[model samples]
Target: MFAARRFVLAARSAASIGSKRAVHKGIEGTPPMRYMSVAERIAVYGLITVSFLSYPTYLMINLDNIRPKGENSLGDNALAEKERRAAVRA
Candidate 1:
């Protein structure tokens, strides 16, 4: 009985899948960017530029915070310290 019910459900799902249709046919061809006003275009381009540049700008601004702990910009003092500790241990 369960197997028959499962078969009925599966058949209904297959029929529903085949009956599916595209509800909205979206705009074809070129995007709507050409229709934008000059100010709108400038604002859109400015936002895009800012978004693209934000990460690099943030990295530059907070370089010390972003770097891994114990790492120095001048050199790898962490490695030297590890070596010194190892020598002391030995």
Candidate 2:
């Protein structure tokens, strides 16, 4: 009896799966920007502008902190040391 009930449920699920239909259809119309008010549009644009500008502004303001400390790959420190030694010797 249990096996028969399980087989019936399996058959029903398989049949229902083949008959599935879409619940929500895609909307076709003008862009959502057309519905926004003037203030909302301005606010959205301002937020976008601030988001783009903030990173460069932050980088410029914290350049000293962001930059690597000490000698770079060019061996500027070694050259400076050599110049100092030469000056001292002279």
lDDT of each: 0.83, 0.85
Global CA lDDT of candidate 2, please?
A: 0.85
Evaluated against the true structure, the overall lDDT of model 1 is 0.83
Shift in Å, residue 40, candidate 1: 0.7
Cα-based RMSD of the predictions, in order? Answer: 12.1, 8.5
* Candidate 1 per-residue C-alpha lDDT over 1-90 given as tens digits, one digit per residue, 9 for 90 to 100: 999999999999988876663333346544789679999999999999999999999989999888778834545797789888999999
Model 1 ranges with Cα > 4 A deviation: 1-27, 69-90
Could you tell me which 10 consecutive residues in candidate 2 have the lowest summed lDDT? 21-30
Per-residue accuracy of model 2 over 33-83 as CA lDDT, tens digit each: 888999999999999999999999999999999988985565779889999
Best model number under TM-score: 2
How many clashing residue pairs are found in candidate 1?
Answer: 0
